[model samples]
Target: MTETRHPMTGNEMSPESAGGMERHAYDVVVVGAGGAGLRAAIAAHDAGARVAVVCKSLLGKAHTVMAEGGIAAAMGNRWPEDNWEVHFRDTMRGGKMLNHWRMAQLHAQQAPERVMELEDWGALFDRTDDGLISQRDFGGHRYARLAHVGDRTGLEMIRTLQQRTVQLGIDVFMELTVTDLFQDDGRISGAFGYWRETGRFVLFEAPAVILATGGIGKSFKVTSNSWEYTGDGHALALRAGASLINMEFVQFHPTGMVWPPSVKGLLVTESVRGDGGVLKNSEGTRFMFDYIPDFFRAETADTEEEADRWYDDKKNNRRPPELLPRDEVARAINSEIKAGRGTPHGGIYLDIASRRTPEFIRKRLPSMYHQFKELADVDITAEPMEIGPTCHYVMGGVEVDPDTQESAVTGLYAVGECSGGMHGSNRLGGNSLGDLLVFGKLAGEAATAYATGLGRARPAVAEDDLRAASHSAVAPFEVEGGDNPYAIQSDLQQSMNDLVGIIRTAGELERSLVEIEALKERARSMAVEGHRQYNPGWHLALDLRNMLLVSESIARAALAREESRGGHTRDDFPQTDHEVWGRKNLVVSLDAAGTGVELSERPLPEMPDELKKYFDEPRKES
Candidate 1:
């Protein structure tokens, strides 16, 4: 074996037995190649930073591509009355007033510009009759606000961002998994990981690291997320001394496929409803009218006729209850299923076929049309879809500075779904894509500024820390008669799905914590039979560490928040407590021993008196 010295740290490094080793140095190292990551890389590179984007999956395959609806922005192309202040109010109210005020303000104000920027970079969104980028209505928005390309807006976004990154010559390291973030003197030093194909060790020596690794949906048994979203970014940030908030508020998108065991939990985008689809019970009754909450009753239509008329004459009628915030919709569906009013396959019906003609459905929702036809042998254009809530997004993530996107740990930044406080208790549909663009650019710029300010002198990765990361990566292969990682993962998913899922209770959450601990114990001796190369079992074993930590955080946070608000619904504490739980958010961090997590309460920042006026009176749109 040949020993080589790291140029920056002067540390002796040798290839581990499992695979060859490679080292790279950059000013900013970005983890995850999703929309947020690519957008960040572009911003950093444009700012003249030597940036590298590392992802577990190939370029263009990030979870962002799975987004079907549209990017939320107050472009006002479709609704002349729509603007940033209204958008901000909708976001804050949609999140149950738990969102970071400054973040929400920035997001709503900047989102329109970001969407326009994408158009300048070659994104081809569907246009309106007058020939401007068309906006579509979605949950929680007062106007048609989402700038989209039919039901494949996310695909267009990734394509546009990826193209921009390539044109800028930013280096992208695809199919690489980052297992650990190394910090020196409480600041980010670099990141360590391995190539997925060969399992060869790779080191990124950088002054700044930005995590945009999407959500924790894969931790649930039923989810719209792909396998790559194992909560790596959340767990990595926590272990690196950053804190996470809102972990309990997991968004179960109200419409996931609930038929054909093979395709259960697949996303049925809210755009279906935005484009006129309606939900019905097995009795063919539009049940959303019966479930409209008092809070939304002022704006939501209580009658089916008014709801249907509002689609064409928004100025005259209240919006449909079907377009309520995701949390409300998901809970309503869960209640319907529990009451035995569900379809034969155990879900409610989303019927656009009856509301829209086949030609119109195909024109507006091409992807949903093909997705159902190809995956489940169902024709969405002809019949209603059997749909239920599925674990879709985690509003909780690494807590960061609202302006800079910098985490508690210096030189470490997080954006998009990996960062918290923006969405609060729940996120509005279409706002996610907007958050990625607005904050992705902000994080990239801030990280670049921090990195370049360090000049030639930068923090160095410790040799011992590097060795420990390598050992942890290979430990599963050396264990004797150890536990199965897949089995542990399966049990953890089931426990989370049944206990800490869409609705929660103190008893169930406490039980979930116990189960998580038990799984963590089993994971200690997780074993794999094959060599690191092409070993999925080993990959899963490694991912289990992240999933366990995130799971614990979610359960612990869920138990701490005793009030039902937004995505966190508790049967024991069913009412929102404005004086207590609503005033603060539970923040999670690694305990002193670094073996477990500890929770603390952080007070929500007050919104300025000027901005507060937007919510003081309800303005009727004309």
Candidate 2:
């Protein structure tokens, strides 16, 4: 495709017109109104600091609401033998031990409390007969560790936080998308963004900033994430000189709907498998038994009877191979498909219809039933669902202290999927919600404490910077003639999916870089026709900036790793290069290239003996 330049004019507020800008000062500014952002705002408010929660979307509709799997926590309900140590081990093993030990430990220890706090705040989760929150088994968890409210755990969690936030009267700036972080004297002062409703620039000057802006799945062709998962926080933090870690590890969900070209690939939630669904190829074979590693061999079932029995009695029988960690399941399906065992649709069938009755399927997997019926025109109740892998979560993000949730950039903090080293290379299913709750609270507490210690020295928000950022954010719409933003976005997604997806080789990574550069050039000339109210064109244009930045980071980091581990697999360098690569993390920073964004390496924090003790062996059932 030829690159086209569109004639454009700046929105009335150019940098030259605004001589000086007015600043609104707050003690803390939390960017992103998702679960982490809301939690941070509430914590900051409770810590006696004036706080503001800024989001690009409506208050209740942040990407957190889209999460379907349950939150992982060691609540010790059904299995009294389970504890934080076992949870910690499972997390590390699932992540391929690339995770920071302390972070994993802290997350496991605090997750139960965080889930309980959500319950206290009026969040209703499906309950056990004993009246505690109900738990279910998810991939990578040794026990039934995920506390859930059916499959809509994130909806319940976010709604509870949103309602609680309203009651607390925390200042919320909804429909405002933060374009840039304004820094003063090497510390983060605040952020500057534009209002999508009015196309006006708003300035927030605060001592502390929390980035909970979620994941980067939108950069790929297919994803489980919503439009908001554009790596905004990651991009903004990178531009402001914060270090990002583990950009190479992107998780490909094992079951996204395949076939329709228009709806593309929509995520079929993993909760289906958690509820007893099995993955089968067209030949009707239980394929995962062929892919089990020696490490998991003892626990995984090889026969249908054993698998069914395991579900009923997890303690006495072997676990189902279908419930292996996401990475394992994805690779198994990939292998089967590659060997010509795939269905006619170029994907395998996830059959829950045969395992359970239609009534049971409808009640348990309601969203799955609804999504397939509405989008794919298939009722999962009678027929097996066609599913395949799609890019989903990034195990890597801005590196932070496991205890404080403070990034290397003194005044900047990150929580949720934007922060790295928690899940390491491959995240365990159901653990993401728990990670958000645990670290969101930590980040909020840390930011509030940092703000409190600073007294009241709010820095100035420069008019020139605000105007420049606002124009950059809205420039795509101003382009009168050029490639459509949606077109460029689709191209970018395809490039990422084709070249930088599930399996990577050096040649493909090189091709992806070239393709990305060309796509980015096209993005600069993108045009939009609609006015700004709920304009998807405007949203895609803004999201493209984040997607480009994150995609580049992922490709560069993947190129540097030179080894296969967890979510990052190299066709050429097929083995894990632990001798050189294991000791250090591939850290991407803006300073390394003199372009204000750079990539380098940093040593992983040494695991203390206290924390390492948990990894001695898999917890034995007493």
Candidate 3:
């Protein structure tokens, strides 16, 4: 596909033109307004930093609001035996022990406090009879550790944080998409972006910048992610010379809708199973019971009575088969479908309709009921929902120090889903929301402390560099005729879904690389027809650059890691080769050519004896 090139003189604003153009400077500039961004802004403001939160969407409408599973925190409500130590162990095991121990430890230790902080900030989580936050059972969690708000946990969390930040008077730049990071003298100086409403470029000069811009799921076809999840933060950080770790481990959620072609990939929240839904084949057999791995065999129930009993008394029995970790369940469903036991739609039936009362289903899963009715024309409360795997989360992202949340670049930082080495291979359901809150606060504190020590040193930003970035951002729109940006995006997604998807092999990955290169070439010639106001076409055009860059990094990292570990499973090399591939994390950087990212090895984090104790205990009930 070819795009028409329109040669128009530049009306784009330079940084100098932005001088009198409402140029707002803050002590910290946050590039996303999701849960992490809001929390980070609040923390920075509390630490005496003038903070601003920038987002691509309207306030309270971040992709974080779409998360349905609850936040994981060991609050000891459902399981008195649950604690941070147990939480840490489950996280590590769920990630296949590839998780950064220190990061996991910090996340586990700090999660409960973060949950309470949200409550104090006015989040109305479900309450137990005794008045503490109520907890729910989620896949891979030994205890009912997830604190939620009726399957709308993300909405409650984001709404509460947004409200709290607004009351605190934090400056917010809604509907602004960051285009480039401005750096000078080996430190971050500021950033440049476009205002979607006015179609004007804006500059933010700040010594500290926080990237809480979520994941890169939009890079794939059939993802349960919003259009905003385009690897912008990961791309921006990488372009600023920051190293990314574990970009290969992308998580595919097992239960996305799979009937209608258009909305087939939308996420069917895990809350369905948490409320006693079952995954069944065409013959009505619960298939997960026969596919338990040794790692999870002790915790899972093979029988219906045991699974039911376990929900009430987790100490004596095992978890329901439907509650297996996402990776295991996804693989099992794939196998069943391949064996001709799948439903007519090629997906297994996720049925809660027959088992639970309609009132209870409606109360526990209102959004699921609404989404299915509106999008798929199926009443989830009355029928089994057809479900399959869809690209959901990126487990690997920009590598940062576990405690500091600081990347290799001194002034650069990453938090939430954009940062890596936290979830290892497969993230347990409900862990991500807690991960965002805990690390978002840490990133803010660390950045504030660092900024405090170095007071008001303005790094030099070049006008030419900023102008070049601005022009680059607007270049696709300048093309009068060419390949459609949407078409290019569609092609990219299809390519990723076909070759770089759940099960990958060497030949398939290589083919994916070739397809990516072709798509990148076509993207350069892509055209945008509409004006910039709420223009999804324009937004997608800009996001394509980040998607292609991050996709290359992911593919490169996957090729380098020879063993099957975590989310990266190489069919050619099926076994986990811990002796060699296990020791070091793959870190990627730009090569001498300044084009493709170079992969280097960094040592796996050392877990102290105290921290390692959590892993030594057998998960079997005493």
Error of 1 at 246 (Å): 0.8
True lDDT of residue 302, candidate 2: 76
Write candidate 2's Cα lDDT for 409-503 as tens digits. 77799999899999988999888888888888888888889888977565566667777776777677789897787888888888898889888
The stretch of ten residues in a row with the least summed lDDT in candidate 1 is 9-18
Query: Best TM-score goes to which candidate?
Result: 1
For model 1, what is the error of residue 227's alpha carbon versus the real structure, in angstroms, after optimal superposition? Answer: 0.3
* Regions more than 4 Å wrong, model 2: 1-23, 474-483, 524-538, 591-597, 618-622
Q: Candidate 1 has what TM-score? A: 0.97
Each candidate's number of clashing pairs is 0, 4, 7
What candidate 1 gets wrong by more than 4 Å, as runs, is 1-20
Model 3: runs farther than 4 Å from truth? 1-22, 312-315, 477-481, 529-535, 620-622
Clashing pairs in 1: none
Per-candidate Cα lDDT values, in order, are 0.92, 0.83, 0.85
lDDT of 3 by residue, 1-622 (tens): 2322211212233344544433556678888988888888888889888778889888898889878879999989877889999899989988888899989998999999999988888888888889888898889988888999998999999899999988987778888899888888888888889888767777887788999999999889888899789999999998888888888888889999998988877999998998889999999998888988877776788788888777556666488978888888887888898899988888999999988899988888889999999988999878999999889999988888888788888777889889999998889999999988998898888877777667766675688987798789778778877899788888888888888888888888888888888888888889988777767788888888889889988888888787777678788888888788877888877667655678889888888999877777655574
- Assess every candidate by TM-score: 0.97, 0.92, 0.94
